[model samples]
Target: MAKSVNQATQAKAKADAVGQARALAPEVPARIGSTPATKFRGNPEIFGRLVEDHDKHRALLAMIEATAPNDPARKALFEEFVRDVHGHAAAEEQALWSTVMRNPETTEFARHAVGDHHKLDKLMADAAARDITSPGWLTHFATLKDEYLEHILEEETEQFLEAEKVLSEADQRYMRKVFERRKKAEKAAAVIEKKIALKPVA
Candidate 1:
């Protein structure tokens, strides 16, 4: 009876996690706005969506630490994470950073975010160098993870919010497309990784 109850609990937990993943997964038509143009005052809907992605990254990072070294699931999760994170950063760099840099009003915020990205890049490089199963892997992930959260908060509050005032309608549309395209690329990479993971090794 105890074993049966434990099995049921585990099953339910797995189901819940799957539901959450689906909820967080990136989808097409990734415009940052759903509200009417007039109502869209600051940060836009896309910024909120990006913040949600951060939450997903946090969950994925935790899962990576929990899984054993050489575990296919862990490898798969890590691959997805790296791809998605790279895409997210690339999208922002392409669309938003330049605007912030060009406009003197938000130059300080842009500089701060760029510095944050530099630190995150270092953290990512450090994490990639070590074995996923190593004792210090979680510690490494924690440091990167904390900086990432801080970066997200600062971007949303300072840069993106200010962007709503400075960027024209055309700029917003262009950026939305850039972010959407990169998200699709991230998903494609995940699919390729999954196929490779399934192949039998000699």
Candidate 2:
């Protein structure tokens, strides 16, 4: 009974934190007319694709936070979140950061973004190691949420602006295609990895 009560308290605290963060976060404007085949210069559509994923992740994180510990909904949502985020980060690193890193002006930003990805990966691993019903799992997940939100904000506001200045329209268009392809591949790999991790130990 005590354990259940404690779990409920932690869940409430986490939900409250997420709520506050959402309330304070500035609205991110959608990139206008960023379609795949758009003929506009600078291929602003790549930012649109990235921002779409960011919005999805933000929603998933919020939904996951709202669920109670050990809730099946939480587990399902978390797994989906993990697959999407891991795939998105890997694809972004290969498609966007790789190009950005070639420009001296954007190189440091690329490095910093990649570093944040690693940190988030570690946080996810730590949380996955803990049973969902435990306080420790929620604690790790909370940290992950905070860090991810900050990272995306920086990428959208600072890194993307810097990258646009450095990349040509051709580069942007090419990366948009590459990001789509790589994201699909990476998400498949993530699913396979998750299955392996969950396999019963022999």
Candidate 3:
């Protein structure tokens, strides 16, 4: 009888602890596969998504650079970087820049940003064509890195500010959703493109 009472008391204590935890937990929105909450300036949904991708790209670039030329890790990292950038740029153009282009105040900014994406794409292609062990490939990659850094800086600072002025909070939220969906499609397309590129010429 004593052992039964002790078990009951322990069960009650465990239930109370769970209740306390639930009470203390912060309320979060119920969304499927949600990214981290935005801590950056501007609309949480819009800039937040872009910032997350930017952070990822930055880390990948650093990791790729740290690897030795001709190393398998370097090759793998570069391939991943190319796919990520391709998907991100295409999706950004479709989701964010397209909306920014609609406003006269932001049209020029969007155009310039899109142009930067094109330049980076070309640089990436040039680097990919070179022998991975050769100095030329590293040089081309370094240039691409420098240019990409500059482009994202301008984007996060200037372009985003101009875009915010023109886009309402509701619009930003909607674009975030569109960006997420389009990015997934673009990433899949990037994979297909990579596979085609790898196929031997017959």
Error of 2 at 135 (Å): 4.8
lDDT against the true structure, each candidate: 0.56, 0.67, 0.65
Q: Estimate each model's TM-score.
A: 0.64, 0.72, 0.73
lDDT tens digits by residue: candidate 1, 113-183 = 77776566666666666666776667766766667766766665556667667776566766777777866
- Candidate 3 residues lying further than 4 Å off, grouped into runs, are 1-43, 191-202
Worst 10 residues of 2 by lDDT: 32-41
Model 3, position 45: C-alpha lDDT score: 69
**Which of the two candidates, 2 or 3, achieves a greater TM-score against the reference?**
3
Supply the global lDDT for candidate 3: 0.65
Ranking by lDDT: 2, 3, 1
Note each model's CA RMSD in angstroms: 13.6, 14.0, 15.5
In candidate 2 the C-alpha lDDT for residue 159 amounts to 76
Cα displacement (Å) at residue 120, model 3? 0.8
- Between candidates 1 and 2, name the one with more favorable lDDT: 2
Question: Residue-pair clashes per candidate, as listed?
Answer: 1, 0, 0
Off by over 4 Å in 1: 1-45, 68-70, 182-202
